[model samples]
Target: MLIPFLIMLREGIEAALIVGIIASYLVQSGRRHLIPAIWIGVLLAAALSLFAGAALQWLSAEFPQKQQEFFEGVVGLVAVAMLTSMVFWMKKSARTLKRRLQDSVEHAVHDHPGSGQGWALIGMVFLAVAREGLESIFFLLAIFQQSRDWAAPLGALAGILVSILIGYGLYSGGVRLDLRRFFRLTGMFILLVAAGLLAGVLRKFHEAGVWNHLQQVVFDLNDTLPMDSPLGTVLSGLFGYQAAPVLGEVIAYVLFLTISLACFLRASTPDTSAGAPTGTAMPAVTSPAASSPASNA
Candidate 1:
């Protein structure tokens, strides 16, 4: 549940931030007429996300046990791929995202600066919302395989809605946020989630007879962290906590977390300069009714 919630929170925040950035840019630049298109795009994307999530859940339950494992394994791998790319993409593009977004908007508007503003605006909103929405669906599906419960999805939805409120507050000048810190903290959690996904993928593979070796039983911790216990269930929801992890799962989780965290932590540092590319940035932000500020980070 924690994993789903956090992932959805982060994902929703990104989408909201993108929309906010675009909206703020337009308002600041006296392009308020473009607002309607953005709204349309945002709503459409949200609907699409809901549809996709429901569809995936419904479709997956139709599979046989073996097929379910296969499907789970495939989705797990894809989720890891998407999750890692998202983190690194943010690290690489966080700095330049604003500039790129700005430039793209400008180019679109200029190329067709008349009624075409609607199209350009819609494009911006669609891409921004859809990107996050699609990612969330994939991540949530991967998470569902582990917990096989409805709470995960409910938690994710709640997380995303809460994130919208947070993004709204930040965008409306209610609070100043250090996105770097936010991502760093969440990134740590994401790493843990990814590690669990990694172990899950391995489990699925083994169940499907993909990798047959390294199946020795590791010391069982079910006695200590019984899955039925509240703490255990919470941990399992968030970090894919295992009561009796097999040797491979244990090794995979540790190795992936150690290596991924090392690289992720090194890359997780926020850009202090807005001039930097996606992963590298000067961390400059435009505050509402105030001068642009550069974070010390």
Candidate 2:
């Protein structure tokens, strides 16, 4: 439950931030007429994401046990990839996000005047929302496959609701978020989650008879901390903890987390080179209002 909640919360916040930024830019730029297009795009993206998730779940249900493992393994791998890329991309782009968005809005409105403007806005917003929505879908799907808990969906729904409220607050100028700090912290958590998912993917593949090597037990803690225990269950859901992990799973989890965390932490160094990209100013830590429209991160 907690795992899905956090993943959805992060994903929801990202989508909300993008929509809020675009909407704010349109309104402030006197292009409020195109605002409805944003909603249209969001609705379309939501519909598509919902449909895709439902289809995948339905299809998985029809598969035999071995095939089910294969499907889950494939989805888990995709989720891991998407989650990792999202973390790194957000870390790199957060600073320039606002400016880049505003520039896109400007181009959308000014580059193609008339009806084309509305279409451009809709397309832009759709792609942005859809990307986040789809990422959430894959992440949640893999999580649900692993935990098989009824509470996971409810937790995810709660996260999305909270994110909507936060996005609204930011847009209304009633909330101030330290995006740099927020993303930095969440990025670390996501890397851990992704590492867990990657390990799970290996297990899934092995179950489907796709991976045969590294079959030896690295350690057995079933009696000490059985997976069925309450604490173990929670840990499994949140951090991919395994009581009797095999050698491969242990190696994969440790290696992925170590290298990913190293890269993520190292990127925290502020770029001071003279070749810094134009309009990539970092927003003030005091308020996202410093960047306008949405968070600077």
Candidate 3:
């Protein structure tokens, strides 16, 4: 539950920020007439995301037991890849995201001139929101398959709701957010989650009979704290905790965390020499339609 909630919260904020940047740029540039187009793009993207998620869920349900395990393993690997890319992309781009967004909007409006401008903006906004939405679906599917608890979806819903509120506050209510700090902390947490998912992926592969080598029992912590216990469930959901992990799973988990964290920390280190920016910071949206601006429309 907590895991899904945090993932959704972070993802929602990212979507909101994109929309906010675009919307703020539009208003500031006196292109407020295109606002409706932005909303239309958002709705369309959301609809598509829902349809895709539902289709995937239905399709997976048709698989046999072993096939299902294989499918889950594949999905888990994909999720890990996507999640890793997302973390690094944000870390690299967050500082300049606003400027880049503003430039793109300016180019879209100016390049297309009058009537065609609206359509161009709509396409842009659609792509932006839809990308985030689709990514969310994939992550949610992976988490849901692993957890299989009622609280998972509920936590996602709550996280999205709270993120919407936070986005709104950041856009219009004059709320200040230290985005650098927020992403840094959350990124670390997410890395841990991803590591757990990696181990789970290996486990799933073994279950599917694809990789059977190194199935040795690394250790047995079930006697100490079983995975099905109340506290254990929470840990398993959030951090991919296991009671009796296999040797391959443990090795994979440790290697993934060590390498991923090292890279993340190195990339995140600030360079303060000369004219370089001293710290990471995101632009503030001070307009009424700030949230809408990120829509690309």
lDDT, model 1, position 180: 73
| Residue pairs in collision within model 2 | none
lDDT of 2 by residue, 1-297 (tens): 877777788888788888887887777667778999999999999999999999999999999999999999999999999999999988888777778988999898899899999999999999999999999999999988876658998999998998888778777767677667787888899999999999999999999999988989988889999999999988888899999899999999999999999999998777768576543433422223344434443
Q: How close is candidate 1 to the true structure, as a TM-score?
A: 0.88
Which model is ahead, 1 or 2, in terms of TM-score? 2
Residue 48, candidate 2: Cα error in Å is 0.9
The lDDT of each candidate is 0.78, 0.85, 0.83
RMSD of each: 3.2, 3.0, 3.3
lDDT digits (tens) for residues 114-157 of candidate 3: 88788888899899889878888888889989867699999999
Tens-digit lDDT track of model 1 for 1-297: 667788989988778777777777787788888889989999888889889878877877898887878878888888887787788777677767778888877887788878888887797788788988888888888877676668887888899889888777766766566787677778777878888888989999888777777888888887777988999877777788888889999999999889988998877654556454444322444545654542323
How far off is residue 35 in model 2, in Å?
Answer: 0.5
Answer with 2 or 3, whichever has the higher TM-score: 3
Report model 2's TM-score to 2 decimal places.
Answer: 0.92
Which candidate, 1 or 2, has the higher lDDT?
Answer: 2
Off by over 4 Å in 3: 288-297
Q: What order do you get sorting by TM-score, best first?
A: 3, 2, 1
Q: In candidate 3, which residue pairs clash?
A: 18-294, 19-294, 19-295, 20-294, 22-293, 22-294, 23-293, 23-294, 121-297, 125-295
